[model samples]
Target: MDAGILFWKAFCENGESELIDLTTIEASMTDSVVATLPVINPSTYTKTISSPVVVIKSEYRRYHHALKASNEAMPINLLYGWGLIGYWGGVMFLGTLWKVGQWFYYLRFNKSKAKDIEKPNQSSQGELALPKSLAMLRHWILLYIVIPATIGTYHQRLFWWSNIPNRLDSLIVFGFWALSIILGFAGYDTFSGNPTVTSLPEQNWEMLSDRTAILSYACLCWLWMFSGRNNIFLWATGFSFQSFNIFHRHIARICTIYAIVHSIGYTVEWIVYYPKYFKSLKENWFIFGIVATIALSIMLGFSSVFLRQRSYEVFLVIHIVLALVVIVALFIHTSYFGTQYNGYLWPTVAIWCFDRFLRLVRLVYCNFSVFSGKAKTTNASVMYSSASDVIRIDLQPTASSLKGRPGQFYYLYQPYTLRGWENHPFTLGAFTNGFEDSSPNTPEIVKKKVTTTTTAQLSDSSDDAVKLKSYRSSSLSNTLTFWIRPYDGWTKRLRNECIKGGGVCYPKILIEGPYGHTQMLHTYDSITMIMGGTGIACAVPYVQDFLGKSKIAISYTSKIKLVWTVRQPEFVEEVCANDLSAAICDQRIEFEFYCSKKNVPTNISTSVHSSDEVTKQIIIQSGRAPVASLIAESGTEAKLSNSRAAVLVCGPAAMADEARAAVHQALKNGCRTLDYFEEAYGW
Candidate 1:
């Protein structure tokens, strides 16, 4: 009989009661058919199967190879998932460790120095040698590696590739790109003979598509993780929101790249392999995938640094809307995979929701209070100074726990305006006790008399000065102030409102945060500040903090120097008359004002000499401030005193860069005890 009949006869005898290993039976039949055939007895099953068995064997082997290939790919997909988690977790771990180290150093060394008298030998001690050495190393890394462009200066100094920012950032992004490419093509065990339109094998296209799709989902989690204002990483690491924002933008680009690759791979596969390519595109999963890719592309295109710098509000709205669209579309696209890939998608939604929830909690806690069945709200008084061309806002929040500190900032919202939801971040310039408002019409003679009497009393007796300080310290009302330089958009409108109300206005303001980490400048022996224009806002609070600490006799900062450069002499005079009045005459502090404009008023020139001995220490000049020389002089002073120093710069881009370069050069020239801090909003 034929081999087909023989196999049928064997199947009837087996009666489906015994399930045979067709794969193993088929393999053995290729070598020796009679020995491997399933039979109750050898005498009853004498017929041999031939070509028919070979045909059936080839069919089973095909599917067996496919299943084997799928099993091999599963672990790689899972590895990509865990790799993302590990990278992010490592960053958080490092941040937490750094924070703990900072706290330990403060408690162990600086705290005791603040409370006790320093021994003469303490100044020459090498106790802080390790930390200073580490600081120098970190500066070297930043100057040579992190801050430079990848290939050339054009990208770093020009607006064309501002998105990447620097070499280190680009390298990090390139690492992810390399990872996706490597994993997409490696470890494939099976391939079909058919070739794709791109000339890649059909199985190669399938694996590449699947891998990129899964990797993109993994990256989505971190993209959302870094976008939050209240990211825990900020608190643990002391990194500014701007640093995380750079990470967010880069991760978004990597994610979009993955998505584009995934989309294109499948598109080519369908066009070449499937006859009904357009029909497949009509499917829900395919359409959602396309939607997600397009949304991501649009988000990346519109989120360029150039465009964001030009119109932030418009960019923000587009970013938010497209973000939602991408998330929803991704959810629908991956829904067909059931719960298999939901692990990556759900965490993304949870992270975004958690961030928004924290923001809501902060808003409620900072703005509203309930006492005896009534709610109280925070109000602000805004005044515009035409001389300085800046807005001064004073806010007193009812929330007792909301205390302002150095380096902290808040988002101010004008609830009564058309765009009430709009808000802007400003540094907390100063905070003081709330006092009863005095009449604006108080006579100049009365003011001069009171001021003269107070000055004489302060000058004549230490006891009287102490009593005045005590009286001021005892009144503890939380009044927070912010100085905003008026520009286009919200700030200009705010200026108009102040102008309309005769240079001052009281608007219902909502405070959203006290964000940012504070630097422990008090731990340093000396401090140098390089400020430009309205960057004085960054300097005033720290000066006041050092003075307050000195009053309590618990500060290590023995010397403070401020170098301010402004366009107008009037602004300098205004700041001196208001913000710098208290600290201006302090013996340990020095002030150097450089006005870029040439025409200095005679009255202003004479005002610096009005106090004679008290104001004689302040130097006023016309020209650009010598940023490098100032930094070098401060370093030299610190070196001579054998004390650690901090150099802080907050100013326009060029001024800040000049200061940074100066500090870096100082470090290279053996200024080991110097630490650098920069305060500027990257956005």
Candidate 2:
């Protein structure tokens, strides 16, 4: 026998079976195939062809297969059957119940609240619950409209039929999905396979089938999208039960379904069409790619909600690595020597990859563009905050590679440091041109500084590039500067050690990621951003952009209010004198500084005062802002009753909770709408 047959023979037998060992035949088979096989004794007749090559059917094996098929078929049928019936039924029943509940609550619970509503100064601070009619209507619209609309839109664009000429395929796919829902709702047999039901017109059956498949895929995305959104909302509302299910358990369930169906369905279909190719799955790169992706997807799909929740950091690293693996497999599977899929999904992936590459290129230029500019060598003095809480530090950037967004940060490094690329994130606090008219005493200080310094020495390449300029103009500067507040980490430890010895800590830094920012800025007519402590950094860049574009609104309520509670009034004075709030001088900007320590001196020289714009309207404590005050200033009884405006909040979770309650109360009184935005660093 050949080695292939022998190997198969070994795989077929087991310890329970009375069969001869296949290893005995390996020596015989290694050199040549057997012309005749060995015969078994009469007592060993059952073991004669015990190997898998023996095609004789077994009642035990048949029973096992039948049981498996029965098990598999039962759950699949039940899953589909229950999904169709339960989903639509639940939607209708819940919607009706919500409406009834709303009306009942409004009459029973809200009547007394209505009495309080007539008194604008009532002291009730709790956020009123959503009323019957509006809440019910919102549920209805969310379920029947937004949920289906986004899914349908995705279906139309992402289906295979979407690729056929004139979009015939996409139309058919969308039509099938619509028909499935309509028929299911009408109590028709949704699984019917009749040509009139399951199949489209003969004129375009192929395109129609492709369309139907595409629509099916969209239903999957819709399910996942809703799950993600639900997770976010539940998390926001402080409902731990719902948030846990939606974010962790429900996400895993949906991801598993998507992965299994995506793998098995296509794999089986391909196998049926080309049995030879399927048999060569291990040998074919295309098939291998699919297998690899499916395996990784399964692992990640489960690990995400389960293992990820336990150790988020570990899960994050593993997930990132697995994602890269899966993406690579997907790329190979799709390319397969170059073939395009008929959908937006693949094209979208390709586009996303291209965009990421472009972003990296832009980031590199942002860091090093000055180096390739007209000047080959430039000497610059940069001032930054050190650990001593003093503003001091000088830099000669032979090249200015540091350019970044206001709210964003960067890592820093110098050629003479331990490494040229070791850097850390520091907020770019201020930017200014190099001083032109240096005092006569400055060069003497510089010469002394260079002569006796072990750390002041620089590479020959960097030394030749350090030239001085005569004038200091903020507009003509090429150097990028940052203000850093060190914490208990590598950067902080190094800075502290260096400053303790009265030496400079100059090291190269590697910068990465400037991905997120405030989006949909133009969506509303008015905007307000509230920051706490270092959260101010997130608002600086956005505020600069808003002011620079002259988009500042005139309404007192439409303006951006900078409410920062610091320890000393001098901090507030420094901000005003530094021209931080210069653009908003006559532009209806309000600044409120709440001094936490009463003994701190109030050294502010500007005309701005705590009582000038917001005295009773604001409160500052050591922690978050007073949410009740924000609601009182921004909330409206009539708008709350009608649902008109939106309220967006971004800060700590606790702060967000207070803000949400206040806004919700205003909604119940009459705010037309309520919307909140929160930023998370990473998970």
Candidate 3:
């Protein structure tokens, strides 16, 4: 018989009964006749064992276990941990560096305190907290938003969030490319490994694990910086939350990519080492990680601008709940698994808590007084107009020192009526010192009475004069005005209430912040304010500001124009009766009111601002706004003045887009340099 048949005969007697060493069998079978003979036919072989046969998984487990303990894996993990720290520290240090740069700009104002800053009462503080000229100052500050995003989008293009305009910069782009190249080589250790040691396979797993942690750490840092009150602090340091918002999607996308990679890496590892993936899933740690990934995916999916615009309150609530769920899932996942990333998650949680605490502190400070109660606190008084469908809220404040300027906004919390627990942001339409409405019909009579009363009471005492002056200043400090056009949710509910209650109701309300730093307006030679309907609120305060100050106070601001488009004639009358009336006496302000709707009302006031420039102050135009023509006129005025024109607009998206187009046209039409300011009340 042949050696092959002899070996086949022996295997049939011993099959599945005992482990046969392949090397020993091969060495014995290699004796001449087996090498010379054809391979044995499968019809000739049969199993002799009574038990079922199974694949032994011991080798796969030993492979991964040995690789983990290998010399190469140890050094790879050490280097990974060190590199992760460097990546995290680098981001934090860059953020700090920009903040420090802004602080240095602030320090430059010490010697000669800017006389032409905020108001006389507000101790001037812009320095570089706000841009002097927008483009030069903003781009440098925008670097913090650009770099991390470049790393993700450079390799792969993600739509809308990926390769969008204004989010990338040259300096940050170069830094990102160079850093990525260095990190890529060092992280993989030049792919050096022995095949027998399984270093290559194990190092692949370790690299993926390390990158997941690094990306996660970075995402948390961004979250801590960009969320609510934390974002406010960063804004104060000259890095606005608006800029940080651009990077939010990019960071989130990158982290998601890392998480997917991590999940796949572990899936492969478990299948190779632990035999059954379902068994690994039984561990709470593995399940939690999977849940976190799912939660993140859902949160990111719902975070589009369209969904937010559709229903911000719902989107906000869901976004927040999902974020909390993700954090909790990640916490449980890392803790039970003994993953080192648990420490990073705590800082994120702490920052979120701090943000909530700070918001609470703001609520208390803005709305209530410790000494008194709700009676002394700033309560919102709602005044609505049925014809215009607008709500004029006059907030009576407790803190007189907390006076805001022309361009700022505050959050309104109206729980009893809005049908939501959150606060809504509104632009500061007008700022009243509280004394304006209460001022006596005649200024001369009021002045005479104050002078007479003080003289008679204290015999012309200097102390009484000083007291009177302080009283006059403090009287005007605490009233804030907001003009809201009812839309949906809170505004719609309020509008219905106003409709039922004869267009006015005073509801108990709480105020939160005066958070904005709307740089300089007085520095410009001419200003053209384009107001779409209720956008008059933003323009009116600036007019009042210009009128109150003299040539000595505002040397640059010679000409001011307000182009207002209102749907109803009643809207113009209501605003003019309140805020616009004050600017009528000032010749520098040339305001026009345009009634856009058909069958224009007879009650529209043709109020003349001056005896000289009677036509300039408040000109009435019918139909839609001639935005392009008005811009061209303003550009001509700026050219005549030999100074840059500032076109400040506050309105609907259509109006804003029109203004932006007109601005481009103005720049083209001999306007030396045009600075555009858009006041959008976006929450």
Candidate 4:
């Protein structure tokens, strides 16, 4: 007797029973059957004894064939049921466990410094009341357990909430929620509801389960691109964690859940339709491979964040490895080798790959260009310090001819004289066509010397006339004229170097960047730039550029006003002595210097908070005519209506914010055109 006959015999005896008899059905149906035989069928078979006898139409061989068909089909339904419920429960359980572990670790290890967490601008003295041990425990448990659970619920609710937004955002939210609800319900139903894909005894639900799992997984991938839709949920549930970091963890959780669905769904589907294939994961390498890939990727992404923050090198390697595994698994999971599969997901994935490739190419070009241009250049310049510790650095183009716009800054690296690796960004103070070299090296001299010299060309082609040396001259000269302030770190070192050797030799300067050109000067007809301390360098460049082109109109009357508030009087003296002298000669320019320490010049208005006289004097003083009235005058509105006026602001962020508001107010009063641009140094 065979397994099919025995199973039928036992199943017949146990009608409407929870436990079906396999041995009796197998023995009664099959004769010397190779598949799921009667030999061991009844060892696991049980009966409810609801019916004593049941008639079988197919006798002997045909009945045996039917029993074999049933056994082969059983595996699919069984596996499908187990996979879905098991994996989902496993992830939720593991997440709960991890939280418990974290709480313990934190409380036991870090108790004292729980209150000493660093925050910007706050005094460090305030101590936390919670002991170090308890704080650590609380922090860890809150992060691991409270965070994920909250985020999951929030994610679901936000999906529903997104439907209330503007059409596009709302559509995205609606579509995502609709798909998620469908998949979740369908997935749960696959295990619990009628688990049969087809009525045929040989056909199983494995193919159906696989299709469902793949669709759900694809949906998860799509959600990655929708940031705004997810933000609501992320904020609500993800409050404990930073927003930017939620996606990876979220995806891992979802993937773990669905992977279980796929595993159990297929397993149960297989068991019901094809019982021989039950617990035959090793035989089905394709299914097992995807499961393995998912498990590994989840572990890698999780470990890299929490356990391996200090092991950056290891984490990076692991991350790359996990990405590769994910790609491979995605490929195999979707492949159709005579299976129920589709290829729509690949093209979307390819786009992401191509985008990353292009970004890499751009980064490489930027890095290579910088690396190739890394050559040391030397120059000598006199540094004259004012009473305010502001240094006036004068240099010829031969030394450093890197010209930049006013307000634009360059990272200066001085290698030979001081520490060059620590680069500092400073705005360009002045511009010159070609500086008068103390030791002249003219273009004619350079041309004559080039015949005997051999150097690489800056341009790649041989026909290109731009040699590396000439390119250096232009690029370097255009990059050099920066005005720096002495601060901590490299600034102090540079000042010390300058003081020690009137000017040091073989100074290797590497200009890193040409950042901060927020002001669009071409857009405005009249622009008033306000500066404090060394910020004057930022305001002066565009003023000089526009004025140099003789774009000034007498009948039109364009006023280029500068209000420079310096702590010391020498700053005004130096500017009057050098850079501003030529510009001041022009009637279109108005410069006001507010010297805070001493009494302001009589020519300028003075409002003093003093004990003596309550008289406010508006001075029109003359040592160097301080244009105090011109500074305070209503030229801004008059000029804006007559022409276009833009307030191009560059200073501290706080100052920029205040100045920006003032500019807006001025525009509101009557300024025809007004634009405010802020350049952030730090944040």
> Which candidate comes out best when scored by lDDT?
1
- The sequence of per-residue lDDT tens digits that candidate 4 reaches over residues 1-683 is 34544574555653544445555754554433443333322223375445323323333444454454445443543444344334433433544565555455345323322332232212111321245586456445433322222222222122432211222223323443454445444432121212122343223245445544654455333333221222223222211112223433444445555566666666665676555454555544556455555655466355543334344435545655665565566556555343333343464365456545644443233223333366333343535252345544443332233444545554455555534334455666665544421111212111111121322221112121122112224322322344566665665666676567543323434544344432435334455666666777776666556555433221121557666665544455444433444454455666565644444332333222112222222122333212223322343654334444545545543454455445444444544334444443321
Looking at candidate 1, what is the lDDT of residue 639? 68
**Steric clashes per prediction:** 0, 30, 2, 80
TM-score of each: 0.81, 0.44, 0.69, 0.40
Candidates, ranked, lDDT: 1, 3, 4, 2
lDDT of each: 0.69, 0.38, 0.59, 0.42
lDDT of 3 by residue, 186-298 (tens): 44432443322345665566566655655555456555555555464455444444444544555565556556667777777667643657886888877988998888788
RMSD of each predicted structure: 8.6, 18.8, 13.0, 21.8
- Judge candidate 4 against the unseen true structure and give its global Cα lDDT, from 0 to 1: 0.42
**What TM-score does prediction 3 earn?**
0.69
Consecutive 10-residue window with the lowest summed lDDT within model 4: 441-450
Displacement of the residue 592 alpha carbon in candidate 3, Å: 3.1
